[model samples]
Target chain A: MMQEIILGDYDLIPDTIPSEGELHLRVKPIDMVTYWRRCGAVANFIANFYRNPQDEIYHLNENLISTTFNELIENAAKYSTKRDSDIDISLKLYNTILKMEVENICSQKHMEAFQKSMEKIIDSDNDELDNFYLNKIEAKHAGDKDSGIGLLMLKKDYSLQLSAKITPIEGEVYRVSVHAYYNMSVE
Target chain B: MELKAGESILKYNSADQTVTIEGSMRLANLMEYDKVSVFLNDAATQASDKLTLDMTKLNFLNSSGITTLSMFILATKKRQNPKLNILGTALFAWQEKSLKNFNKLWNEVEISIQ
Candidate 1:
C-alpha cells in the first residue's frame, strides 16, 4: 500500500474502505484554497459517517472534526515548500477515537517550527495552555501573531494529541507528517 | 456592506448596527482580513449603540480569519462606543467551543449562543 501510493505515484485520487466503524479518504489538494475546501469536505463526511442516534456528541462531532481537519490541512498548505508535492491525507477510525495524518514535503524552517510547537504543547499543563492561548490572542490584537496559534488550539481547544515526525527527503527538504488523535466521545 | 462568495456571506447593516456572517470564512489570507477590519471599523463608527454579529450559519473559520475577528472585537472594545454583542447561533460544536473564547477577549463583550 505504501509503495504503490507514496513511493510510485499519487494522482489526487481519493481511496476509501468501508468498515463497521472505519472510513478513509485521501486527496492531494492543488493549492491553499483548494486544501481548505477539501478539508471541509472530508470533515463533513467523517462527521456524518459517525453520526448515530446513540451518540451523545452528535451535534458537536461534525464541527470538531471539521475544525481539527481544517487546522491540519491549513498547516500542511501553509508550510509546505513543494506546492506540487502530494499532500497525502488519511483518516482512520478505531471505535470512538478518530486519527488523522497529513504528510507533505516542507521546508526545514517549517519542520523546526512544528517541532518547537509540539514541545511547548507537550510540556505545558492545562492552565498554561489557557494562559498561553490568551496571550497569543492578545498578540493577534497587536498584529504580532505566530504560527503556534493553530498548533496550540489543536491540543488545548480540540484536545488532540498532536505530534510531528520529520524525515529527510533530500538536502534542505523534509517530509513532515503531522498526526492528530482525538477522542470523539470524550468531547 | 455585503460580501458573498461560494458558501460564505458577510453582511453589515449600518442602520441596525448588525453584522451577519454565514457559511465558511477562509479568506485568501490575512491581507483580506485587513479589508474586513476596515469594513467593520466603518460599521462600528455608524452603530447606534451596539454591534451584534449573527454567526449561527458560519460553519468554518480558519485560524487567520479567527485572528482577524478577534482583532476586530478587540478594536471595538477599545473604542468603547458600540457595545460588542455576538449572537452566536452556531449549532456546530466548534462554534460553541470556539466562540466562547471571544468572551475572554473582553469581559464586557456579550456573547449569546442560542
Candidate 2:
C-alpha cells in the first residue's frame, strides 16, 4: 500500500498515512527562490515535528535539520537538469534514526566523484572539513559538469548515503536519489 | 553585487576592499567554495594591510558565509597585516562561532560582535 503526502511541490509517496512522517520538495529552476525558502521551512518543520509532546522517539535538533536541508538544496540546485524538474525529498523516522532522501536528475559520473568526496569530508571534523572545502574551492578543477561535494558532505557529516543510479523513465530521463541519516549520536 | 532589503541597499565595494553585507550576509545562490574563492581573491586585491568587513545589519549567515569570513582572516594573516579588524554590530550566533573558528586560524584578526 503506497502512502500519499503532499506538501509544497512534492507529492509524497504512499500518501495514505503518517506512520513515518515525510516531506517532498519539488525542484525546478523556476522554483529556485521557493526551493531555498522551503529548505528553511523543512528544517523548522523537522524540528517541530520531533519536538512534539506526543512523540518520545527521537530528538531532532535544529543544526541537524539545517545541515540536512542546506545540503539537500545545494544538491537540488546543482543536479536538477530541466528548468521545471522536481526534486523529490522525503524524511522517515525509523526507531532512533531519521533518514532523509533527496532525489533529482543527474549523470552517474557526477554521482561517483560526489560519493568519494563525501566519504573524505565526513571522516573529518569542522577544522579538517573547512580546509577540505577551501582546498576544493581553490582548486577550481572539476569535471566539465560536476556537482562536487554537495552530496558527499551531507552524507559525511550527517551519515548520508547517496543512492545514485540512472533510472531510465520515458526514453532517457534519469532520476538520482541521495539519502542522509540522523541518528542518536547526532548531537 | 547590490542587494535591496527593507529600506537600504547592501553593497559590495570590489574596489575598496569593503563589503557592506547587510540583512543576511548569507547568499542562497552562492556555493561555499565559489563564494570563498571569490572573496579571498577580492580581499587580496582590494584590501591592504587592514581589511574591514562592515556587517552592520547582518542578521543571518550560513556555514559558507563563515568560510568566506575565515578566508578573509586567512588572507590578512598571510599578508601579515598589523591589524586585521572585523568590525560589526549585532552579529548572529553563527557569526560569533565563525569568528572563534577564524581565531583558531589567525588569532590577530580582532573580531568584535556587538
Candidate 3:
C-alpha cells in the first residue's frame, strides 16, 4: 500500500513561481562523504548566484543563504537510505523569497524518523521549540550523532518555514522531499 | 595541537589556553568530529583560569560541529573547572544567532560577539 504524509506548511509551497534565478544540483550520498567540501562549495555557489552588491545586507545574506543551504544538503545526504541514489536539490528565488527543495530516497526507518522530527517542530510554539532544541542538545549521548539540531536551528533561529512530503515508493523505501522557505528581506 | 582538514583549521594553544577555529567545517559525521571534540575537551581541562574559544575567523560550522562544541560546554559545565569564554565575530549571521545558544546550555558561558 502506498502512503503519503505531509507535514508543516505544505500548502505554502507554491505550485510554480516565476523565479528570478534557479539552480539544480544532484549528488549521491556516498560521494558527499567522500568529498565533503561539495556541500559548502555548492552552497557558496548558490549564495553568489543571488548576490546583489548594492544591497547593504549582501555579506550577511550571503552567509545566511550559504549556511542555510549547506545544512539542508548535508541533512539530505546524511539521512538518505540508498548510498548510490542521487539527492536532488533545487533552489529558486522569487524576488526576496528563497525557496529550497531537497529530495532523497529513504528507508522506512529514516522516513519515520524524519516525519517525527518534522512533526515535533511543526507542533511547537516559539518557547516550546526553543526548549525542545535545548533539551535535544543537552540529551546527546556519546554514541548519538545527529539530534536534528540543524533543522531546529533553521526554524528557531532563522524563522524559516520548513515542510516535508513523504511518499512510499516500494516495499520499505520512500521518497522524502524537504522544503524550506526563507524571506531574504528580513534582518 | 592542531588538526587541519580541507580549508578548515582547528588549533589549540596551550600558552594562552585558547582554541582557535577558522574556515568552513563541514565534517562528515560525529566520528569525524571526534578529533575536534577531543582537542576541545583537552583544552578545557588544561586551562588554569579561563579557556577561550576564538571562533571569530570560523566563518562556517555545520550542525555536527555545533553539537561537538555544545557537548564540550556541557562537559565543562559538569566538571565545574576552567571558565568558558567564546569569542565570536559579528561578520557571520550564524554567529550572532547560534553562538548565543551556548549560553543557554550553560549560563555561565561568557560569549562576546565583536
Q: Highest DockQ among the candidates is held by which one?
A: 3
Q: Residue by residue across A109-184, what tens digits does model 2's lDDT show?
A: 5544544655465456666776775565444333222334444345333444334333544433456565565565
i-RMS for every candidate (Å) is 2.3, 5.3, 1.3
Give Cα distance to truth, residue A15, candidate 3, Å.
2.6
Question: TM-score for all predictions?
Answer: 0.84, 0.59, 0.94
Worst 10 residues of 3 chain B by lDDT: B1-10
TM-score of 3: 0.94
Model 3, B21-90: lDDT tens digits are: 9998888777888888888887777889799999999988888888878888888888887899999988
True contacts kept of each: 0.51, 0.02, 0.67
lDDT of 2 at A25: 52
Task: Choose 2 or 3, whichever is better by TM-score.
Answer: 3
Clashing pairs in 3: none
- The sequence of per-residue lDDT tens digits that candidate 2 reaches over residues B1-114 is 554532223565666656576654334533533544564456555556555666656655554455445555565666686355666653343343344455566767667787
Rank candidates, TM-score, best first.
3, 1, 2
DockQ per model, Cα = 0.46, 0.18, 0.73
Give lDDT for model 2: 0.53
lDDT of 3: 0.84
Candidate 2 local Cα displacement, residue A31, angstroms: 1.0
Better of 2 and 3 by lDDT: 3
